[model samples]
Target: MALRTVLSDPMLRMLALAVLLAVIIPVGSQTRPAADLLVSAGVFVLFLLNGMRIARSEIRLGLRNWRFLLPLLLWVFGAMALAGMALSSLGQGLIPPLIAVGFLYLGSLPSTVQSATSYSALAGGNLGLSVISAALVNIAGIFVTVPVFFLLGGTGSEAQIGWESAERILLILLLPFVIGQIVQGWTRDFIARHGRHIIWIDRLVIALAVYVAFSGAVEQGIWQRVDASAWTWLGGMVAVFLLFGHLGSWVVAGALRLPRPDRISFLFAGTQKSTAVGVPLAAILFPPEIAGFLVVPLMLYHLTQLVVAAPVAGALRRAG
Candidate 1:
């Protein structure tokens, strides 16, 4: 039972898969063509499944909660952007430029849906609020991210959203998601019965994306450029960033005088970054060489948030 619990833990599973892929895929014989195709297909399917899982009622509920939703959005997109810009500017020499860019990009992302909602429920939070808030933020992020990136000076002429990239995003991510939602009425039963399997699919896609990203980085001699001390510093910075983000959210929640459940929802939803969306967007927005570096902060933040938030959620649950 304990072993199963450990294996089933999303953070543990993600960490194991990422570490394994980072080590193996670089040395393996997976060609670039194959990796690209696999990563693209995986991202498409992942988003499709996500769309199918979210019900229309949830969307309606999310839209109605303007009082809570407005503040959450401001914190996620506005305050976080300021925090990221501050970090990048202040740590100019301390951290690698690309890694700092990674931090900025991470800040531009949306809150996580599955893990955030799950943790909120476990922490005895308002589960509906978590679900609706997470869903709404991600949907908004799809359109908002490009402008946010440009505003942060993270994009250049080459990185600008060309017709091809926009087409790819529409066809690969949005189209299938629309199809999924359209068919949800007919497929609702099957989705409910087998919805849990989607978790494995999500994990597999993330691992594959990590593997492909790292493989490209390895080919670009990422190791020679980023040494051990750099990695150590990057890891420390990521930890600090996540801790600060969580505590800041807590403070904001308190100042607003939010109820306990809403506060718990705010903490998890506000602090957690979406790896599922961030990885795919990075792959599309940046070249392979830099995409790997850009995603490193995201991966680190994802893991760190989970580790820190899990215990806090448990404590909240116990106290409740």
Candidate 2:
């Protein structure tokens, strides 16, 4: 009956956002830069607010577990770098670099606190390890990503360094996390007291972000070049990449004689890519057309990985 009730249910909320995005199709044809900037800023707020719920202690512990953390970090960066090179070999030029950067960002990002912890728990991983790993990646991304962008030649060249695109991303993402950590020291009890209320707000923010992002893309006329066939290839490639990434992580884990819990952590967290982080970064770094094509694969992959990984994770749990 209530607006929050209507928007806080995950399935219904996501569907509602998707429909909102669909309707934005017509509105997008005429929206101006001011409107687009406003929408982007809204999404950026969600990014910051999401970090506020996480405590600083969780982050500190996530960093201290360097054995598991270090290897996973290497795997993420290595896989992304290789993916870039491999795609280039297949004759995909600008799109490959964009995608590689997406994958790299994927690698460098902190694990989804809820999703990673849920999967790790379901698949029998070390819970503390999962928490720490997620925190470490996110914290590291704040520092690592800036240097990475420069090292990968994302400086004053094309994306326009003077515009402070990289700085904006860091400010939106990293600044919030650090602030939350500082606040957590004093407000831990208060935060925990209102945790249930916070959950609904969190969902609302995510739903709004999804709506804004899709709408902004529509506003930019990104869908013009996206055809049915293009979507199909994107879907197909995502499926292939998901299978390969999962298997690759599994093989590496087993070869290293990792424990069962560690292996499961490696497989799911390592293989599942984040479109939330990837889409915004792509939008910033690439021309509209190039970003559109590059984003197609990630969106498909994001959808398919959840569908496919759920069953696979369940099967693994049953076997164990």
Please give each candidate's TM-score. 0.90, 0.76
Deviation from native of the Cα of residue 119 in model 2, angstroms: 1.7
Overall local distance difference test of candidate 1: 0.78
- Residue 288 in candidate 2 has what lDDT? 42
lDDT of 1 by residue, 60-121 (tens): 88889887888898888878866776666655576666767777788888898888898899
Which model scores highest in lDDT? 1
Cα lDDT computed for each candidate against the true fold: 0.78, 0.56
128-193 per-residue lDDT for model 2 (tens digits):
776667656655655564455455544323333444665666666666656666666666777679
lDDT of 1 at 260: 91
Instruction: Candidate 2: count the clashes.
Output: 1
Q: Which stretches of candidate 2 lie over 4 Å from their true place?
A: 1-16, 19-51, 88-110, 145-163, 200-209, 219-221, 279-294
Model 2 — TM-score against the truth? 0.76
Residue 73 CA displacement from its true place in model 1, Å = 1.3
